[model samples]
Target: MVEFYIGTVDEMLQSTLISAFPIALLIWMMTKQRALPSHIALPITALLVGLIQLFYFHSDGRLLGANIISGVLSVLTPISIVAGAILLNRVLAISGAEAVIGRWLDSISNNKVAQLMIIGWAFAFMLEGASGFGTPAAIAAPMLVGLGFQPIKVAIFALIMNSVPVSFGAVGTPIWFGFEALALSPSDLLEVANQTALINAVAALLIPILALKFVVSGSLIRQNLVFILLSILSCTLPYYALANWNYEFPSLLGGAVGLMMNIFLAKANIGLHTTQNTLNKQTKVPSREVFFALLPLGLLIVILIVTRISPLGIKGLLTSTNAWLGIDIGGSHLGVSQSLVVSLENILSTSVSWSYKTLYVPALIPFVLVVLISIPLLNLSKTQVKEAFFETGQRIQLPLVSLAAALVMVNLMMLGAEQSPIFLIANAFATLTGDSWSLFAALLGALGSFFSGSATVSNLTFGGIQQTIAAQVGLPVNLVLALQSVGAAMGNMVCINNIIAVSAILGIHHKEGFILKKTILPLLVYGGVAALMAIVLS
Candidate 1:
């Protein structure tokens, strides 16, 4: 049991993360040494973090509930959003919607560089906006596969591209939920989250293009310097600007703008030749044929946008209900309260708030959108529509299971950290890093997310610490916290659970290390860039 001079209950509660660190480190080391299987290592790591906290710390039910709520919410919020995107994507795939999109995109430009820009950069960002969970990888992976890239290479490229819109992903669920749980003032939290999201958006534009060009032809990158720099500048600038103006739509809107421009710009190419010919002339789905294939997807986007708009969209037409149920402890309710402390059995027992926004307008609209318009759109039959649903369901099985399991593991770890000595470790680090803390703040933020696998959790764990350190040292508080947010998101690339969930969906089993290996350098590079940004901003 670790004790500190900080007497406030909240401060005491936060100390647990500091206390839990060494134990977590030990577990991670042991897990690595044994090369424990994911299923085993995840649960074991989760349990150890929980047990260490519960026995060592004394907390009110409300404190405990806060942690629990976040876990439960993770399952529903971002995870559900992910499931919806997957289902929608799967539906589109079975109905040939992606092919439609591919053909439409191809018709706009036949050049390979243009195609890469569209698919890898623009298209990937759009998917990131609509459904970010494992979707960028899911959608882009197969698209690259269809483009003649090997399965593993496709997966890697998709994964690399996925990083761009992650901070604001899934309708801003991570930041949105993180603020609510931490009990921060909405405006301040939104500002920090949005700024950080923008920072990543800028990086998003540059990294993928550079990575792609480098991956394809390292020397060829020099030839397209002007176009590449412009592309990077276009996305990075607007993403940052608009993010501060409007948080929810930065990635969605910015990606859309950049992607549209990328299509046209890629038309007048320099001279970068891909080692592997991307276009499959033998299996290329024709342009006209591709349009019909894409009808359902176009309808999906339209329906999603329209329904949320004027008086007749999906929300106006659908009924709303509170589907969430869980134990109410202390001053907080179940799901919401559990988020404040450590998320324990939050996954299984935390409340589910049944809000009607997009998931429930009835699959009928999309179905009709697909079946009716798609007849002329894709030249498909009733049989194909039915097959799409079946295929979508089949593909969803592993991902959904992996999602649920991953959520449980995350919940358990949150609970453990809340009750253990790990939080004290966090406090000590914060203390040592005071004043010149932006870099360290970012590092701590990254660590919180690495352990918890959520940027919101990273903020919750370290937000107050950053603020306190700034106040004490007379440093710029907002800048440090902003850096914290950036680091937290960067941490997602290497977060074990997210990596595992994504890898499982792509059928790259028993290769968590490989995925982590791919992500580490990128994460470090991004983190270093963010630290530089923090210094400049500070």
Candidate 2:
């Protein structure tokens, strides 16, 4: 194990300087360079950070290579989900589901504000649950544009709504993988989820209001106050309830049913009492086409629910690995590896993983199954199916590389860098804040997400540090961890991957910084809400 030093003030400052370079470089490049692809920025940053660790922190090169390899492998599940989301979205569009959804926009509400509630707020939330990986912004922003909303406003709403369900995103990947490294108990997971849900419960109320203000300058908010409250409760009540036992589905199920209920209200013209603009002239779509187009989404929901929640022993079968793959490089999850042991069970292994099962991840099995079934059910043409498959694969290539590199960066800072410069920063914050660290705990968490561009990575990077601080400072451990999760989720708005997703879908690659600027206010709102709540609850 690399020695963790608690050195002098000068040593601490030196450690912080060496460690902070890579992260600061990342932020500067992403915000300053208009055309630098994430795939490029991330990998280079990873390499640079590794070098800095070797020379400055005295980290071992071989171990660093192994950690980077592990980092690349660890992120496969989320990367697959991202690819699946993009493919599913392409398939839906090919089957006219995008158009079908657009047609329903006209039927739901003539008023733009009401329309934003359903699609941008509720429906976007649903996408965040179902496909996340920034897919919500990819889907919702274009849909809003089709409804005649300005492109900028569409992007803003999509990015803002993304904040609500990020911890539960990609079917709770963040919640699961975020704390997986720490190996927290299931009950602790629930407690963490409860705290995150509490902060998001406020978000459930506040997001729609923010959306309305973005749409019409808050004039229509009073007239639609009841509608806002209802929308909030609809997502909040079941969301909190689901967090109690089923951490994966609070956002998934909550967003799914919330979208449906909100759709029902909009179609029934329940929330259209105040505004009467058609938003845009759209043709009435046939119910058959809409249902067929929505087959993938419906199937995705059914598959996730059944596989994840059923007591019929379905998940057990799905989770079982016929073979275990083992890596020979000597490294351990606890710290450094000792040896590469042979697993006589079966032939399933990678450079980073030993005894890993085939399709061991929840996301891989369900999403792949959903895609195969969806191809035939959606009546997707051979050409269209082929197109969607190839297109999604192509689009995700750079993104997957970017994500892996980001994970590599995290692992580099973690595994063997002597607890990292980030840990030192956290320690300093804990010492500085003393009794009031709650105010900045979430900020640190947000920075983790911002730098890594993943809530799971953020959690993996900072969860233990934050936990250590909580224990040292006598802060509420669960609540502080909850703030970490929530802040990471909120960081989705500013994360490079998410920004790329939104901009890629809208065909506005240059507006990344512009989008970042507009979305910061909402991030502050979300961070502020979580911070204040953490202070009060603590």
Expressed as tens digits, the lDDT of each residue in 403-501 for candidate 2 is: 788777877776553357667666666666776777777778887877667788788888887787787778888888898898888888777666655
Name the best candidate (by lDDT).
2
Which stretches of model 2 miss by more than 4 angstroms? 1-5, 33-35, 124-156, 168-192, 211-226, 241-249, 277-283, 310-312, 322-368, 501-511
Candidate with the greatest TM-score versus the true structure = 2
**Which residues of candidate 1, in runs, are more than 4 Å off?**
1-37, 54-113, 130-134, 170-198, 201-206, 213-215, 220-225, 270-287, 306-402, 416-422, 451-453
Encode model 1's per-residue lDDT on 261-340: one tens digit a residue. Answer: 77656644433233322444555567656655654655655554454333464453443433334455543333312112
Model 2: ten consecutive residues of lowest lDDT: 338-347
Model 2 residue 452 CA deviation (Å) reads 4.1
Report residue 186 deviation for candidate 1 (angstroms). Answer: 8.8
Per-model lDDT: 0.57, 0.69
Query: Lowest summed-lDDT stretch of 10 residues in model 1?
Result: 335-344
TM-score for each predicted model, relative to the true structure: 0.73, 0.81
